[model samples]
Target chain A: IAGITQAPTSQILAAGRRMTLRCTQDMRHNAMYWYRQDLGLGLRLIHYSNTAGTTGKGEVPDGYSVSRANTDDFPLTLASAVPSQTSVYFCASSDGQGAEAFFGQGTRLTVV
Target chain B: TQLLEQSPQFLSIQEGENLTVYCNSSSVFSSLQWYRQEPGEGPVLLVTVVTGGEVKKLKRLTFQFGDARKDSSLHITAAQPGDTGLYLCAGWANNLFFGTGTRLTVIP
Candidate 1:
């Protein structure tokens, strides 16, 4: 009842199409992150927001963009989806110190 | 970019066996954490070790942080089917960097 929530549990998108993954947390944490989980690659950071209205690129930020319009929401958008962009996306939140991260269930997206 | 590499990408063992999974990195971290993830779900934090050479235990699972703060390990005693999952290690600096992860399967 009090944690991160990711919408569109799973999706299938055509190539060159646009898609957005929604993430919302009720904890009001200061930090939010987006990551893509692939087979054998683990979870690679896509984008991160230290606080409201601030965003930074992570290890793999290509083809993806994120905006932290407010403390409760951080949405990841794929301007033009590709086959390689298909993967499980996760949203996580941590405190200001970045001690521990609480994650959402994840969204499974497939680009064909 | 800092990379955390986990050894033995995948492992399958019989129930009641003991096993160890290692997470190695060249970059020293202020802290390290372990997480367990099951299919169709996100990873859940298991333990966090900050100080170098620190060891923390939770039930049958023991976690150790390298003295140099660049590596860590998880040892499970008497593995059980319930312990089967993908184990991940993350290093903490200004942000968190994760390893490739080790998938473990325990058979009954």
Candidate 2:
């Protein structure tokens, strides 16, 4: 069973462009999170959804937004990409708070 | 904001050598999790420690949570090339906070 899936395995976009990273999970988890990983910076949470129709900002949420329209999907959108946003984005889901999380194959994004 | 700090940002050692990585934080956590990520892939869960002073083992890897619930450690015995990856520790407060990470390379 595909636990979690992330789209656009890799992408390169010019600055000021718009991009949306798609994530879907079949585990029916109640909590989902988006994180960006960079060299020496580790993984920083960008956004999170507690459940369907509820989203919250994370440690790094300035240039990104997320929508949780349903329990199976959480999409992260960059209204206008910037060079600083170039990094590997990961999508994760857990059964509930403080539970072990399962991550998807990351999306490598390069904003030039 | 709670911050998790990992020691020895990078480690490279010969195969069969034993090593330990640490994850420390000033704030207490309800639970702690460890993950390993290889190149071109997302971090995969390794283990989770909930009770303070708990110790859990996975094959040759042993994980321990501090009695105060503010720190944790991962120890690998007789490391192999297949164990090379980025190791990260995450603490769960109201939300999960990740450490900077320790990149481990085991040379065969």
Candidate 3:
């Protein structure tokens, strides 16, 4: 069973281009999160959704957007990519607040 | 933002040696979790500590939570090459905040 699946395992895009990272979970978790990992700077939250139809800004929300259309899908989009946005992105989910989280493999994005 | 700070951003130890990694925070939390991420993969939950001053063990790894719920630690007995990875500590407030991370390398 695929707990969480992320698409485009790796991508390289030019600046000003639009890109979307897809995340899907078969666990039916209510809470979903998007995080970016970089050297020295651990995992920084980009955006999160407590439940379907709702989304919230995280610590590093700028330059990114997320949409939770249904329980199983939460997609993060970059309106216009920038070089500084290059990082490994991770998608995670949990049953509810404060519960154990499950993470996806990751998406390596390079904004050149 | 409530920050969780982990000591020794990088660690290299010989196999069969014991090591302890720490995570400290000024803000209290209801619960804390530890995760380990191997190269090219996302972080995976290793353990969760809820009660203050609680300790849990998984094989050779032992996890402890501070009495104030603001700190935690993970001790691995007899480090192995398989245990090499990036270790992170996280706490849940409004959202999950992760520590800088401890990259451990176990050399044989």
**lDDT scores in order:** 0.94, 0.94, 0.94
Docking band of candidate 2: medium
Off by over 4 Å in 2: none
The worst-scoring run of ten residues by lDDT in candidate 2 chain B lies at B1-10
Task: For residues B11-95, write the lDDT of model 1, one tens digit per residue.
Answer: 9999999999999999999999999999999999999999999999999999999999999999999999999999999998777
Off by over 4 Å in 3: none
Instruction: Mark the 10 consecutive residues where model 3 chain A has the least summed lDDT.
Output: A93-102
Q: Could you tell me which residue pairs clash in candidate 1?
A: none
Write model 2 residue lDDT over A1-112, tens digit each, in one string.
9998999999999999999999999999999999999888789999999899999999999999999999999999999999999999999999887888899999999999
Q: What is the lDDT, from 0 to 100, of the residue B61 in candidate 2?
A: 100
Report the Cα interface RMSD of each model, rounded to 1 decimal. 1.6, 1.7, 1.6
DockQ (C-alpha based) per candidate is 0.71, 0.70, 0.69
Alpha carbon deviation, residue B19, candidate 1 (Å) = 0.3
Q: How close to the true structure is residue B59 of candidate 3, measured as C-alpha lDDT?
A: 96
Candidate 3 residue lDDT tens string, A18-40:
99999999999999999999898
Candidate 1 lDDT (Cα, whole model)?
0.94
Give me the displacement of residue A68 in model 1, in angstroms.
Answer: 0.7
TM-score (chain B) of candidate 2? 0.97
Sort the predicted structures by DockQ, highest score first.
1, 2, 3
